[model samples]
Target: MSVQDYTSRLSDPASRKMGTFSYLPEMTKDQIRKQVEWVVKHGWNPAIEHTEPQFAMSNYWYMWKLPMFGEIDVDAIIAELDACHAANPGNHVRFVGYNNFTQSQGANMVVYRGIPV
Candidate 1:
């Protein structure tokens, strides 16, 4: 079956408890910056990941690039996010805040969603 067909048959929920403010509406740019700042202040590294539209419902996602640890600059992070979005305009992009103390646990938030044509 085509990936689109498989995706169409999936029944994922509209909302997921992924990030700190995920229970609320999708955050604005300012809000996102605040969250990123908080994460950086707490010594967490930020990372970006995305999945193409065809695999939006899949558990697997491709990393946009390496994690941005030790980089407290929010603009740089946002720039990377924008770059990723520009590169994959038809994909679902998300931000991940990785905590070293957690070993393998991290907070995730969807940052950009490309509308299907």
Candidate 2:
């Protein structure tokens, strides 16, 4: 086949195009809890963000609020995600782990996929 066809075969346009965990299947609530738990175990601060599906691959996303400092409860984090999703039902919701020491992102994954507007 042609190079364009070969490349297209290797890439899935249907997949979620977020920063991390994009290659994996859509994460369930339990999986999200596990990921948040890992973030807490690593002492990484948690944050939430959202964006329109069309902007999912964009570099910038609207932060739900300030990065949650010293957040240890996974349920609270999930609740914040829920709140953001409730407010922006038409936007994709994601959870992120921020490393204060590194001043960079540790991990991020899309937890909820929004309906296309």
Candidate 3:
């Protein structure tokens, strides 16, 4: 599916937004495939991983999914995420899976991750 179609699926109100951070809210499997069609799509910066909410979808239950993105400007990405947060309230972004306290054998953290548009 195209980005527009993929977005439509994510916005499906009946699907119940769980408000956990992972990939883009509107991202789809096909969208990911297309997004990666070009050779070596870059993340610019690494993704901010986060855990799924307690009541999230089955796919998010126990697995840690890393979202990839294409080339994008950092400022633009941040601004977009901020806008998403404003529109979606608290579901648009989050941070998790990292341990800042200890640098020894620490688990990753989750946060609002961005992918190239």
* Winning model by lDDT: 2
Write down the RMSD of candidate 2 (Cα, Å). Answer: 4.4
**Predicted model with the maximum TM-score:** 2
Q: Write the per-residue lDDT of candidate 2 for residues 1-117, one digit (tens) a residue.
A: 654222222135344455547556778888889999999999999999998876666458999999999999888999999999999998889889999789898888889887643
Q: How high is the CA lDDT of each candidate model? A: 0.75, 0.83, 0.34
Deviation in angstroms for 106 in model 3? 14
Poorest 10 consecutive residues of model 1 by lDDT? Answer: 4-13
TM-scores for all candidates? Answer: 0.76, 0.81, 0.28
Question: After superposing candidate 2, which stretches have Cα over 4 Å from the reference?
Answer: 1-16
Candidates sorted by lDDT, best first:
2, 1, 3
Which regions of candidate 3 fall more than 4 Å away from where they truly are?
1-68, 95-117
Superposition TM-score, candidate 3 onto the true structure: 0.28
Residues 57-117, model 3: lDDT tens digits: 3444332235224424444333443454455442324322222234221222223332212
Query: Model 2: number of clashes?
Result: 0
